[model samples]
Target: MWFHGPDKMINVHKMDRTCMALSFLSFDRKQDRRKQSAGAAGRKRFSVDFPFEAFTRDIWIICVSNVVGAFGEGLYFWVFPLYVMSLQADYIQLAIVTSALMGFAALVPIPGGLLADRLDRKKIIILSWTPWIFAPLIYSFAQDWTQLIPGTVCWGVSMLGLPAITAYVISSVGDEKKVTSVLSFVWASYSFSYIFAPAVGTYLATIIGMRSVLQISA
Candidate 1:
């Protein structure tokens, strides 16, 4: 007999993709470092200037946006499957929807990065949040999976702003040396929210139901 767990399979696939992306990113970083080292070896001046005001603003914005976005994402993860199940979707349908969303998300960042280089970063952030504000209300009214597809597509497209947001943070910090520290702080906050939001969302779902949780998340 054959045994398969759908959730486990999906998780394994995601892990594989993440590892591959990480490996490529690491290689790219190494190439960048080699080029930087060659440039530095040819230079004779080393000046350290700390722009405290600019650094403060950059850190504040990155921290605030990351925390808020992580909370929204965490709440969505907790409630979306429950919402779909409420609409009479089976496990296979749920998996299909999730896979589509993830597929679009992973593919969109490249275009997003290119567009971010050419466009106003702040506008991109606002535009990303625009669909999210409306998608949940649409989800609230959805009586079937067909009605859910539009909102799902909107949600998927909104993820294009993620790369833009990341680029903006890196640009704002200015000092490449501190970029990792700044990003780590922001990511730590985001990770912390994921640790707590699920339990709270689950309790809320039990008390007020999934639709209400979706509304709150939206």
Candidate 2:
């Protein structure tokens, strides 16, 4: 029925609204299904099974290698300041020594990355440790800048192996996802060792002196 003058009335059926709601729900369900299918396909394409043997063996080797490196790093970092102080070096000289060692260490990672792509990473790591065998011995005899400079440079070069060791672990594990967890564990251990190393160095320096501390570090 239509009303005259200024207004008109119309009736709408409730069934139409119900139909619209149902259609929307149906569309949503289809979208969800498509998403699920895509996710499953993606997972199938990239998911890697945990290689238990490889994981265990590689983790052990990485741990041992990192521990050895960490031991040297902690001692080197902790004792250097003391060593410089023993020489009665002024702040400027100390800064120079620190800069030389750290700057070279920072620069090494770039070339090390290139080498890592082409070289056997494990061999690189072993070769890196070889420098430690002599660096400390040389530092023990360092009475002036001449001896100190070369020893510090060698220490910096030795650190170049770090990235290679990391690359080896990642490659050996064969799963990129686990790299963070593994590295976290290694770094936690490294931090713990660093905390205690200074105390040990201080005690040793008091007893046997700075040269002995450098020898022990090496």
Stretches of model 2 off by over 4 angstroms after superposition: 1-54
For candidate 2, the C-alpha RMSD (Å) to the true structure equals 7.9
lDDT of 2 at 108: 77
Report clash pairs, candidate 1.
none
Show the lowest summed lDDT stretch of 10 residues, model 2. 5-14
Q: Best candidate per lDDT, number?
A: 1
TM-score, each model? 0.69, 0.69
RMSD of each: 23.7, 7.9
Error of 1 at 137 (Å): 2.6
- Candidate 1 per-residue lDDT, tens place, 85-167, comes to 87889999888777777887788777878889999987887788777666666777889866777777777778778787777
Instruction: Sum up the clashes in candidate 1.
Output: 0
